[model samples]
Target: MVSIEMIVAARARLRGHARRTPLLSSPFLDEIAGRRLFIKAECLQHTGSFKFRGGWSAVSALEPEVRARGVIAFSSGNHAQGVALAARLHGVPSVIIMPDDAPKLKISNTRALGAEVVLYDRAKEDRDAIGARLSEERRLTLIKPFDEPQVIAGQGTTGLEIAEQAEEEGVSSAEVLAPCGGGGLTSGIALALEARTPGFRVRPCEPEGFDDTTRSLASGRIERNATLSGSICDAIITPQPGNITFPILKRLAGPGIVVTDEEALRAMALAFTRLKIVVEPGGAVALAAALFHGEQLQEDAAIVVTSGGNVDDEMFARALALRG
Candidate 1:
């Protein structure tokens, strides 16, 4: 479990690096939900996602010798860019292993950031096996996408900032929501909120077809390892919650709420049209939950962390059409 001290340390370590992303009020969502809504726009973060918080935190926490050895990670998109950018900041080399079906924009962005990219087949080949072999052969330190304590601690800083921003804005006990893929961001937010405010409720927003966190919370075990289907939310396409993130989420999160692909696409379009922000399908899941799952939220003041904004042009048009 991550402690408040760890979050504080992470904040200090990432002080100059990570953006103090804004918490913008959404009157549109507020009118729809009949409650105030604040968005912590991590999509505006460096590398265009909140993943940089954990990525930089993990890399910065490493010992000098480990940094000297460099790092390796497996990710489909946002985390890949995070690791690549973080490694570059620390003057360390990084190797990223991504699924062959990973987004082309993400692959190109990772390469642009000076990281070596290796593609593997997620269906036919095991990415973990390939990563392990590479780690052993190259003597590189493995930096997992979401399963490490330092990574969780780093992610917790976002929650810490949110709580502080809420307090500054004179709102107490707001409902905090985040997109859950491998559970890193959700678990970290819950831990930080529980420690800092103790009155706030942190919830996970998941894609309907890929609601592993929701199903796992309902079943009392992390068992949904099936591949996601029929969704444009590729950034959050995970088979299951991360082993390290599941237990923490179970202990700290309120509940997992699932939103459909249509809802997510609508939310993405709404964000882009109204807020003038470009949010990807996965990043808009929290907003979808707010719009579609309002009954579960009741009259609570809500805050959704818009996680990323990387989307292809064709997909963006499709999402906009879904809104219509």
Candidate 2:
């Protein structure tokens, strides 16, 4: 488990390295939700997602010799680019094993960031095993997307930022909705809030039919999704919660929420119309839950953590064309 102290340290280590993405305000969203609805615009972050914090956190923690040997990671998109960029910044070579079916933009961006890209068939090959083999063969340090303590602590930096930024905006209490994938961002934010903003609660939001984090919290154990490839919210469809992240989310997060694919599209459109921001489907789930499931949350005010905005042109057009 990662502590608040580690998160604080991560912020120090990431100084000037990661962007301090802003908390955006939308009067339209406030009117619709009937509360002060602030958006934590993490999509504006480096690599277009908050995953860079964790990648930088993990890679920067390595000993000099180990760092020289480099790092490897497996991801559908967001984390792939994050690790690639983070390793590049540290002068460390990175190898990314990504699903061949992952978004073209994500794969291209990862390679452009200077990481070696390995493609695997999601339905036939085990990405985890492939990553492990390459890591062992190359003496590369494996940076697990969310389970690593350093990664969690680095991601917790987002929560820390939200707490401070909210206080600056005179928000004494608020519920934070974050997209869930292996519970990394959600669990990390939950811990940060639990320590700093005691009145604020972090809630994990997921796409319907892929709500493993919610089910795991309910069942008091890890739960795996039935399938991984169906959702348009491709960036978040982790098979199960991380062993390290699940316990933290189970302990710190408020009850989780799930929204449908349509709802996510609606949120994406709304983000563009109201927030003037672009958000991918997986990243839009948090705002979707907050928009469509406001009654379920106890708080009058909330922060929707928009996690990413890396969609292809066709998908972006499809999201915008979606009707209520």
Most lDDT-accurate candidate: 2
* lDDT comparing candidate 2 with the true structure: 0.91
lDDT of 1 by residue, 111-169 (tens): 99999999988778998899999999989999888888889998899999999999998
Candidate 1's TM-score reads 0.97
In each prediction, how many residue pairs overlap at the backbone (N, C-alpha, C within less than 3 A)? 0, 0
Model 2 pairs whose backbones collide: none
Candidate 2, 9-128: lDDT as tens digits: 999999999999999988888887767789999999999999999999999888989999999999998999999999999888999999999999999999999999999999998887
Q: What is the C-alpha lDDT of each candidate?
A: 0.88, 0.91
Question: Mind sharing the TM-score for model 2?
Answer: 0.98
Clashes of 2: 0
**Model 1 worst lDDT run, 10 consecutive residues:** 223-232
